[model samples]
Target: MQAVILAAGKCTRFWPLNEKHKSLFRIMGRPLISFCLENLKRAGLKEVIIVQGKKRDIENELKKEKISGLKIRYVIQEKPLGTGHALKTAYSYLKEKILVLNGDDYYGAQEFKKVLSFFPSILVKEEKDPTSFGVIVPQKNYVKEIAEKSKKPPSNLVNAGCYFIPKSILKEKIKKSSRREYEITDYLRKLAKKEKLAFFKAKEWSPLSYCWNLFDIKEILIKSLKREIKGIVESNCQIKGRVFVEQGTIIKSSSHIEGPVYIGKNCQIGPNCCIKPGSVIGDNCRVGQAVEIKNTILGANNKVSHLSYLGDSIVEEGANLGAGTIIANLRFDKEKIKTVVNGKIVETKRKKFGSVFGKGVQTGINVSIMPGVLIGREAVIGPHTLVKENIKEGTAFYSHFAGFKKEKKRI
Candidate 1:
């Protein structure tokens, strides 16, 4: 059997972090799509086809990984049409029964095997809010209908974006949806009406629909981690629980590391810092003295300077947090944190979500970022600045005794 992964969509909803393909987002130093590919390979599918956008960023990123024994092929979609268009673009390469999956989501190998056990099936999961997903209506053992984000959903079971279908399904013509793009759900709906589609309930589904979803995926990945200390831990440091320290990393004295934590290669930890559980520091990162990191993910080369407090936040690669930088993660009211996405306010569903910093974001000393704020790539925050809103890419934010100011970045 062959597998096709649809990865060509322009994930605009995942702003700030959407600088690259959404699947390229890393968890535990591995891309999310790489996990999907590994699961597919374990499910007995050796030949895989990836449908990527014209930029081919997904293909380029995967080339850095050392994946063996899988015959991987890439197909360019050329345009941002839709999932249906992406599937059609790869139709010439697909043969026999094909397992289709969404590249941005993560599924377990057992889930893939269960879906493959029932051919011509769509994997569905029970979700509390089906309005955001394609709700499935079942009849007996087959799928009765597939409704896409209907206000009054027929069932709570939603499409899990994994399908086992024949190659001939791609030949059927699908009209453009109201969103002006062809959707793959149209073909599934047609198959449901013909009573040829079956339904399989998925046991696990980790989707990256929003930025905060990264925390959820991180928690999921950390569960499988065991204690493997490959670095040098000073005598005074207190290491607890399951911690994975990579090569060339050093934990300085007096630092307290609570685990289920992952420290990537060649990193420098603190001499008097407290690294709480669920924290992941990427390669070449630095966590300086008196820093308290809790449930935060720091990407490659990030520098959390001395006396900084980063909790429940995600800092992308190459960001420099100056001394005394504080990221507030909770609201005074103790309610769910809300963030602006695509110019609209959306609930993060997390009560403790700190700011998300894009790549190369530089924060000056004594900078304080409010909860749910998203700083864009290459942005600069001047010293003593109290950021309360989202900062656009390449913008400079500063505050003085007179008032706050926003200007185009000079550096």
Candidate 2:
């Protein structure tokens, strides 16, 4: 059996998260898609086909982590088509049974094993929002109807987007979906007419559709890190609990690090900083003096200087937060925060949703970003600004209360 990893989606919903592909984002110091590839290899899969776009970042990373036995093949998703079109592009090598999945989401190994055992089947899961996903109405134990975003869904069992299809089924013509793209769900709709599509329940799943979705599994994954130290630690640094410090990371003096935390490679933790549980600092990151990072995932090369409070947010790579930059993760009313993804308001279901900054973005000193605000890619927030809403890409926003006061004096 072969696995087709669909890594070609441009991930436009994740604005300010860089133009690079989403699968290339690292988790615990490893590329996200590599985890899926590694699992496929571990499951005795030899031929793994990864469909990528023109972006070479994902392709380069795959070359860096070359496995011995797996025959890695890269196919280009030429145009911005739907998932069904992507599968059609890789049809030449898809022999026997094929396992298909999205690259950004992680489908667990055990679930993959179950799907593999029940080949030529579709996997479904019970979700809270059935309309937000492709839903499957089941009859007895088999899939009866696969509906694409039913406003009134018959059942909560959603299509998890993991399909186990035989080579014979790949020949059907997938109709163009209402979204103006070829969809695999169209074929599955046809498949349900004749064959009883075997349904398997998905135990674990997560979709990376928006910025705050990064925090969905934060606490669970941070604790699962291997508590081993490979980095240099100063004698004055206080380290406690189950902390996993990857290679090239350094803990400076008087910095208190509590466990259930993962510090990635080449990171520098401060002289007088405090890092609490559920903190995942990525590679080459810097946490400076009097700073506190709690239950946050800082992407690579992010620098949080002195007198800052960063909590419960996903800061993308190459972002810089200046001194006294306090990210307001919680609302004054203490309600769950929401964000706009693809022009739709999505309730994050998390109270703590700090600002999400894109790559190479900078925040000036004393910046206060309100809870759940999204700053776009390459955008800059001027010093002392109180950001209340989303910032568009490549723009700079500055809040000037002093200027307003000066004008009032003239009036």
Candidate 3:
């Protein structure tokens, strides 16, 4: 069976990190979609169609990767309609049975193979809070109904966005839901009523619905990595656990690294620094002296200056953190950190989520960013500034006279 991956969403909820498609977000020096494509290839699927946004960014990014023997065709979804509309845009290309998946989610090859074993099947996972997703009601081996984001969900088995369905379902016209957007679950609900829509429970599912979800994905990816070192580890440096250091990277003397950590190519780790576990440092990054990086994803070409502490954060490409900068990842009361997403205050359910730095972001010396703050792309934070809220794109934020006077200038 052929596969269709839905990647056309605007991802407004993933702001500050949504400069590109969510699938293009990298883990372990490769885009997340590349991993999904590789998994699909391993599942013995040769033909794949990707439904991407009008910008064609996902296609452009995926073209750089060499997933041999997988023939990928890109279909454009010009509008910001829901999943049903996105899938409908690729309907003309559907032939025979189709395996559908969400581009932003991580699924294993075994899960794909399991779903493909049954005809007209929907992959479901038992979730604690089913209200956030489309919960599936099962009748024997088939799906009875699908409730989309219902306050009173019938069951905890939620739709995992992987479906093995016949092409005849694509021919049926789908109506817009109450949200005024076409939903794929509506088609599933109709199918459950008329026919036996088979259901398969997935072994694992990692959906990147929010920015902090990256942490969970990172942890999952890092666990599968084996220890390999091609870089220079100087004497007096202490390395422990499963650490993968790429070529041309140097771990200087007096530095300590505890892994489940990945250091990419050409990175210069400090002579005196601490890299704690669950940290992935990308290529061409500079983690200088007296810096302590813990459980953070440092993108390529980033510079973490001396005396800085970045913990539980995601610093995107080309960001430079000035000296003595500290990112606070926890609150005084230790409650779950709440972040503003699309003007709504949403709890992160994580007590230690640091700020998210967008691409090319620059911070001055002694900058202090609070927990869960999102600094937009190319934004500048002046020295001695304490950032507590979200900063918009291209903004220049500064404070004077011990932060008594605050200013925001759009760059």
Compare candidates 2 and 3 on TM-score and give the better one: 3
lDDT of each: 0.90, 0.81, 0.90
Q: lDDT of model 1 at residue 174?
A: 86
Model 3: per-residue Cα lDDT over 1-411, one tens digit each: 599999999888888889999889877899999888889989999999999999999999888887788999999999878888898898888987899899999998889988988788989998887877878878898898887778898999989999988777766778788888998887777777777889889876788898889998898789788889899999899999999999999999999999889999999999899999999999999998989999999999999899999999999899999999999999999999999999999888898999898899999999999999999999999999999899999999997663366678877
lDDT of 2 by residue, 192-310 (tens): 88687888998766777775666654554564676788998887888888899999988888889898899989988988889988888889998888899988888889999899998
lDDT of 3: 0.90
lDDT of 1: 0.90
Q: Candidate 3: misplaced stretches above 4 Å?
A: 402-411
- After superposition of all CA atoms, the RMSD between model 3 and the true structure is 4.6
Off by over 4 Å in 1: 403-411
